[model samples]
Target chain A: MSPPNALDSARAFVVDDEEAVRESIALLLRSVGIASRCFADARTFMADYHPDDPGCLVLDVRMPRMSGLELQDELNRRGWTLPLIFITGHGDVSMAVEAMQAGAFDFLQKPFKDDDLIRRVQKALEHDRAQRQQRRGLTELQHRYDSLTPREREIAERLVAGESNKVVAIDLGLSERTIELHRAHVMEKMVARGLAQLVQMILQLRGSSRGDR
Target chain B: MSIPPLAPDENPLPAPPAESARTNFASEDRLSALLDAAVDPIVLIDSAGRILRFSRAAERLFGYGSDEVLGRNVKLLMPQAYAQDHDQYIHRYQQTGTPRIIGIGREVTAQRKDGSTFPIDLSVGEFRSGAEQGFVGILRDISERKRQEQELLRSTAELRLIFDNAPTAMSITDIRGHILDANHACQVLLGYQRDDLLQRRYTDLTVDEDRAALVADFLSLNAVDDSFSREVRFRTPDGGVLYALLYAGVVCDIEQRSLLMIVGLIDRSALFAATREADELRDRLVHAGRLGMLGEMVSGIAHEVNQPLTAIANYANAGRRLLQNGLTDAAELVSILDKIGSQADRAGQVIRSLRSLTRKREQLRERLDCNALIEDVSRLMELDLRANGLRLQLKLSPALPPVHGDAVQIQQVVLNLIRNAAEAMQERRGDEFVRVTSSARARAVVEICVSDSGPGLSAEVEDRLFEPFLTTKAEGMGLGLSICKSIVSAHGGELLYRRGERGGAEFVLRLPTATE
Candidate 1:
């Protein structure tokens, strides 16, 4: 069999204490040519984890030592951004609400159809990839914004806050021409080719910084 | 009947309890020849107690010659201790004419020529030898008769000892059923003193229901030579009734008259009650065992059925995928169909085994192959063994004979044993084995031993292993082994267990081969 292509390398990691469950889920993924790794418990999964690896996590909710929610918190603490889908034997309402509120991508109860699990894993992998790209763009934007002079940086913040160039100049008691020139310098340093693109970059940076917080 | 050698004017007199006196001793020389021919040793003594003659028999008995004893005091043949009394008796008899030494019998010790003293019966008679008054005493050696009587006494005492110490309680009752004698065991068995029993009739000790029977047996003894025995309820001292075996026969005197009836009793209350209780417990266990087995079957039902269900689903799903891909081969389709069909059938078989478990049927004794019975049970428990990470080793002897038992009950026993062995290793993992071995042991018994590799039971649990509801497991009702033991014993077998060589539990069940 040929190895998985790079685009399909965003593997799904499955953690469950039940050997049969892990094997079945992995077999289902393999049937559709999706790569997957399996671990019997959270500790073993954590021990073998590659922080920079591109994957999604499929975990059981009610594990013995380390529950799925606890593992989610552990992943967040380590600053890893893998999206997770939970599998629960007891799919009670309160548990579902708690998992979803804690940012679980999705959860499916046991004896679920193979299609349901495969779809969730694919979606989680897609979400994680998109988040990775967003973070990279945010980091580049923050670097360019850091290069601005103090006055230019101040003007740039006002621009990102939705203040027009004239309004920002009036509030800072500067001449409209100086505000325009500073805006021009700000757009150059941040590499925004258009006003709309500059606004979108600043918004993306805000969302990513909020997520980091 | 009269004493020998009477005087001329005397009348005949009767001899005493030691009777049968000899006569015809009229002349000295004739009497001398007569005395010599007599079987009893005889010595002739005169009125002064001097010996006149010693016959040849007397000489032979006293180890002396007649010349040596003649003209001497007859006391010379008497023991020295008796000499003074003998002389005085003779003096008194001559003075009073009371005839103490004549026409009367006395027992005295006679001295031999060697000075050894032996008992003899001496009788004296008054005789006249040409107007001289003299006493002719006839002496007899009675040692042989005394020895024979002593031997008879000793034998009677020995028989009495055997009767008194015998385990079978024995008593002798008169023809009227009144107790004449009772041995020690009989007294203890009836819980009565010898005097108490003697005061009451033998029928009084028996319950009212059995009184007539006992009396009939006693009354019929006179007509029967051999003993007649029957079981009767006899009253104890504390008012409780005990079952006893009574054997009665008549003991008769030599004149063919009934003397007493001998009755023998044995206490069978304890033995009889225990046997009854055991039979009842066996029936109850058979019921309880059915319930216990049902619980185990229900508990493992999912796992047992899930395996085949999983396989069936996999096969069906695989075939569906193949068809969806438009890549189905006829051979592959047929193979997949076969697997799905058989797996469903396998699940159905488990359900049928459950039906067998639930059937509360009576014990139907069937001659069954022991090895095959084991195979059926293990097949039912295949999933359970796998789920608990246990490996089963079956070492059934090929030449095992068929055993007579209730197949379902024996199946319950095997199921309990295998399930217990599997549960014992629930906490352990790989390399653990649950081994079942069947062999034809000595005495036509087939034995099955279930041994495991898990840790054996604790010391406290080992002590009370088969006690109901005393279990080591957290969820255990603990009647499993107890019910198994009852089932085995009810089939005329035994259930036994011990610590295994590898520190696990080993349970051995032995059942007898079919008698037919």
Candidate 2:
């Protein structure tokens, strides 16, 4: 039931108030050669969970004391981007809609086929890995952008805005040759092999700084 | 025979020289006419017991003519029993000059012309005319007065018999609250002896709380036929309380003056207790019916059953996957099989509990942990809360003392409160939550509070929140809170509503501890 490109270190975290449901989901994941951890309630899961973990969370939508959705809200408040897959016994349409609107990766009704769950878990895991990779790439781009000189950063911003070297030089009251030299350094430091890639990196960094993950 | 003078004097007063004999003759004629006009029957007898004269009234009363008994013995007018003793008595009295019937009037039996006996009043006096001594007896018939006296005696005895044998407790009291007479049943009902009860006042037997009202009712009875009735509690000699319906009325004389108050008590303690029990049973039935009709409860039960089934399916499918993967771990396979079996049992348990809840079974009182009861309800309500976009937070105390009540009924109360909280928060937009807390309170009570983070109750609703048929919801019957209150009160507990600290409604249910 494992996806073709399933990562070796990726795991599945199962949280449910029902012991039988929590353990069985973990067992199903184990059968597919996927390592899994289980929690009896949302609180225990929250205590040991980290957003950096390369995994997807399998959560029971209804739990005593603190429900799965509340835990998801807490995670969102903390700015953690852990992928969530909600499982509900009632298959409540309104609950599914709410969970989806709250940025849930997927919602599955209880008594779902093993293949269906396995497929969703794999897809969620893939999404989590991809998000983490993009985050890492952005971090690397931020570091390289920090390495640029002040003049190169100014030219980089103008270049990403579709400004020509001649216009940028005139606007900054500098020579076109000086602006061209700064632009070349900006591209090299940003690790963009082309103008399109450099512009994309600059835009990505701008979007992240505006809290648009 | 010479006619005896009508006068009783031994010697007539010497006539005035100027008066004539003719004047005396005229006065004598007038006196003879006056004797016949008397209303009472009058008869005159001589010293030898012979009748000397029978007046016109005497002739009619004895059923005889005056001429027939002019010289007959007076014994003819007497019954045989008195006649035999009368002749000897007159002879002895004449010889000894001692008066038996001479100057004293006495009642004696008399015989008439037809030989029927009647009662009469008789008096005799001696008179002499020139040494010819004679006794004159005057007689008056009194049969009518005797008949009326006998009639009064019989009816009084009948009234006494009826009062003593009546089933209702009855007592007659003076206007001052003093008991004048008490019947047999009154003694038994009050748990007192007849003599002891008579000494007690009506106010003495009445319970302290009802004493004032009873006194007021008694004092207000001033007119003939005035009456009042009410349910009252009385304290018996053995320190037991009795409930009774008291009916009291004033007894009056012919002159319309109130004489006494007659009280009747009908025992109603058993009836009152039965009615209370019936009310409790009806409340329980209504609660069960409400639970059956709740849509959220049905969905919650469905979700509960699905949980274990889902777990069983997951285990089964995982085992199949293992087998298909060519796994050889026998221990793991056995564990998976065991888990699937237990999960199936879990689902069965949920269904069984649900059946017990919805079934209209006799309410059974048993010791129950409040925390456990809350947890059971929380399990059933979790799915419903989620479906309504609400969250539930439980903070059950770990060591709460057990409460004694019907388990199903108490759980139903808790479920109702949770559902109400959820419904209250339906109009809320964000961060909706219902919190349930259980803890041990002072005075050996277990407290469970269900509060919501929704709009608090309005002033109008808070006043009559537990009244039946008072509803804020469009489709609600409004019996939920009222039934819950009744159920709790039946179990010797209290259900109270107050504004929660979170600016929402909070319901506190406090049950007496089982040990208490």
Candidate 3:
């Protein structure tokens, strides 16, 4: 694999009610070749941003208008799955424990190094990119399956079940000549070149069912 | 032969009876006279329904002369109600041939000629002469005998009633020591039933370990001629043992035989249980109070130590910076030592505070308004309340009279109550509050009420509440309330409990107000 690029190559959002702290964080991200949008609080971030892009969030733990935890909650409510990093001036161990437990990427105490901040931001961006790519791959597989005809679906089930052309045609009351044609269509549409490969694909799909729940 | 005139004591008295026969008749008459002269009342009535004779004894008993009643109806000596029936009774007996009352002795009522009735025993004998039949009835007055019998019956009944209903347990046993009877109180006190105790013997009621020793004591008592008495435990049916003061005695019946042993029982079960509870409570309270005092002292130590350490850190940081810049010298070292001395003074102040708190002393009483003392403690804890995000409501009644008590001791109680209230509400969210109220109870009484908005005391804790150091807190030593109870009781009053308005705990302290 090639080396990953800076966070600015992707997208980033900084949400804090303190304009000074917000601008300083934005500047810190820029100094490291990362680009970002800034919001004064959670409300402005909600109205302005699109979540589908691969990005990381920089948030302040305490804010007068919509705190960082509340913003995390609102983003979850809206199904905007961004990796969140929190910043606090007076960080207690329990509060830190709680924020980490809630899936926060990292927490940076005040007066932290600009280098340290950028390192975590880059890491969070990469995680976001990987998750988005996986979801895209799933969607492409879903689209391919949706294009199949009813007759093609029956052929595919039997193929996954390790049935031969002769047995499948006998079960469906079709001739072997027509069965061979549908068999080629099942492999090509499912992007599986062999019986082993097709079975592996079905197994992968079945194991990931819990992620839906 | 038809007309021979015999001379007196001549012609052999027609070959008459011998002289010895006449002598025998005279002796029989003398014996009859002796019977008549006896002190006991005697009367003879013939079967012909006639009073044949009555002795001087009978005269004293019936108040009548022998001639007056001789050959007269004996029924005349009876009451008017019995006289008319007497003749019919005699006539019916002579016809039935079954001899209704003849030859039988029985007790019945007799009436004197003066109209007084007394009990008597009458025995009858039957005589027959061809067709003439007769009954000889002998009468003995028995008024004294009846009185003696009644006295004996009353004593027996009264003793039985006492055994059955005595508030203290009691039992009776035979000479062999087996229980013959037990009272209801004995059943409740020993936790046994009448069936369980009967024939079981005194040794069985005692705990097995003590049975042999108790039997030996009883034997010793019999030998020395003293009653056997001791305090012992009798096992109960429900498996709880009871404490009792027991007493046993050797008693003899009319035949001079050891027929019964009287056992008296006085239960001390409640007193013993209460004493045990008191001891356990005192131990727990002391332990908990010591732990709590240790915790407070540690916190104070931390605060005191932290200030000096902070100063040391500042000094070190400053000295390092100065030395790095080449500005430190011997003069700067002198100032550092002075700073250390000042920090030592601050530490000293902390030790004194701890010393004052942990110092023990006999409580000294004074006159002061309990309401005012509570307010002072509350103000002292104001910062702690704010730090924990709690609010306070003071509803002290106006002009609360001064109470006689140890001010410092009562102050300690108030502080502990407030601190407990604060701790109970620590984990809960939303408007947490503690309210203190005071009221003028009566002319000589004052009540101080403390209530909190935390979860209330559980029912289990409430029951054994005043018993020393029982506590619901995980880290608590459980001594706070017990000490509070001690302090309140010392003031000649009571500490009462109730549920707070916000579904929590409420404690009220009632103290005797100081005289004006």
Candidate 4:
């Protein structure tokens, strides 16, 4: 049995120049109850691919016209976060290393055991699902934060920095009663259950924004 | 010179006293003395064919004494054949008054006293002592001159035999290249009869392209010892071309004057063909060896094979999973099994192609699409190029004419050039590319150019780029380009190199299109 959250709509995308290889990978994924699509080359896969799709890409590293690494670069440039699983053939260690450095989920040498490929694909799908959820959560949090009044946002930033309610009210040169009211509004808008939860959400937003570059 | 007056007993004919008185004894004695003193052996015969007077030199020449044959028939001095006809000839001459030997000198065979035969010059004169009309025949021994003439004739006959029977084709031509004489070999080699060949000028048989040079060589044969030899092409009457080594020399007289041009031709057509065939075989072997030695090619082939194997493995494992889980119907399982089978076949196909590529085989030529060849080579090199972080761009012209050449050999040449281009750009960073282009050139020629985006060749390396044993790579035998060049040339094509527009080395291979 697969994980409920990861496999509900998870699909495997197999891209290889070889028709048999591409078809067989799709077949293997299908046998494992995972839905799949096959593409004869990276360019075709890119043409039909959507950034919002919940899937893991099983890519052959040595396709003609456009190789797997090049496709990875294109995906990165478009700011798509689809997880990539590279299938390297013989003597493709250097390419595999390069793919890994470019944020690939994993790589498998050709003729690898079916279980190894299935396991990697499942893991890549789980990772992709988790990443999408995190991104959605961050977007929602930003929307909540965007809805805040400017004065309330300033008070929330200081409180999340571990300043006391009294200290935050002084730094803003406002009444403690005024700061307390603004904190309540901040927590309500961000949908935080408590002060600790509010602190974690704001920190996560700051870290993710820095990583966006 | 002294005269020994013949005693009465030794005289062949006794002079009558009345005739002797009419001619005086002093005059007779002086005439006898003059005849005896002559260096040439002479004998006097009468009209009856009997000997009348014998000089002393004649005695030493014929080995006879006058005392022994004072009245013997002159037939005794002739060979059997001449002796039998002498008497009749004399009688015929006397009756008809036809001067056979009279006032005419002839060479006739004479015999010595013992039995040896020798040649003589004979002349007869009619003399009258009284009422008798007698013929006085004078003869001279000419054996030494005759022996010299026979010697000259024998040597000339031997020289003629050697010249006519020599194995090499030979001809004697005037300075204008007009053939005066051609030997049997020359006639056979040219596919012409001896008389027909003799009627042709040496330039006529020469291939039209070579005729001017041959004429120039002939005109320069002014010195008595002038001679030259070179490889030339000759056209036969049947329109076949013959490769030959031609040697021309001037034949001179003893006075060192140029007389005739003696030309010799050794047919080298078969030898030239054999050499070309051997060169082709050698190139094929080297090509196979180079393919084997190419590390990048081996890795690429391995990757190609692995792709299929991986597919097969995936299918086999998938089939097992479906069967175990009962997750597929029989039809679906069968389809998966079929996929597995074809994948194995795919892997086997890759191996078979690799085996054929590296196998030492006879050079086989057929009409081939150059675009197809370039595409095949590009497929083979895909992984290698990717591994090096390089891109290959193919700009193949569609509807290209087919070129005639060995498929394997041509593929090898294309692969070598691509590999060389890849290596040249291997060290360069950023946007490295190797471009392969195929297009039809003028005159029914197909051109394939392999160029890279790396540094072009150095001047020193470019000078000897195609020379064997010249290598920039440490592991290279430096025979790749040379062998490729030979293979292209053997196919009646050309391989050229130049700096590409991208400022990298470019090799252009042009092969003639196959004519239907």
What residue pairs are clashing in model 3? A8-A35, B288-B477, B469-B478
Error of 2 at B389 (Å): 29
Task: Write down the C-alpha DockQ for each prediction.
Answer: 0.03, 0.32, 0.01, 0.35
Worst 10 residues of 4 chain A by lDDT: A1-10
lDDT of 2: 0.79
Poorly placed runs, candidate 1 (over 4 Å): A1-213, B1-31, B34-39, B94-102, B128-131, B283-287, B290-293, B296-516
Instruction: Look at candidate 1 and give me any clashing residue pairs.
Output: none
Report how far off residue A160 is in candidate 1 (Å): 99
- TM-score of the first chain in candidate 3 relative to the native first chain: 0.86
Per-chain TM-score of candidate 3, chain B? 0.53
Candidate No. with top TM-score:
2
- The TM-score measured for candidate 1 stands at 0.42
Give stretches of model 4 more than 4 Å off: A1-213, B1-26, B126-138, B254-258, B282-296, B301-516
In candidate 4 chain B, what residue range of length 10 has the lowest lDDT sum? B1-10
TM-score of each: 0.42, 0.43, 0.40, 0.42
Candidate 4 CAPRI category: acceptable
Q: After superposition, how far is residue B205 of candidate 2 from its true place, in Å?
A: 11
Report, for all candidates in order, the number of backbone clashes.
0, 2, 3, 0
- Model 3 lDDT at residue B120: 83
Top of the candidates by lDDT: 4
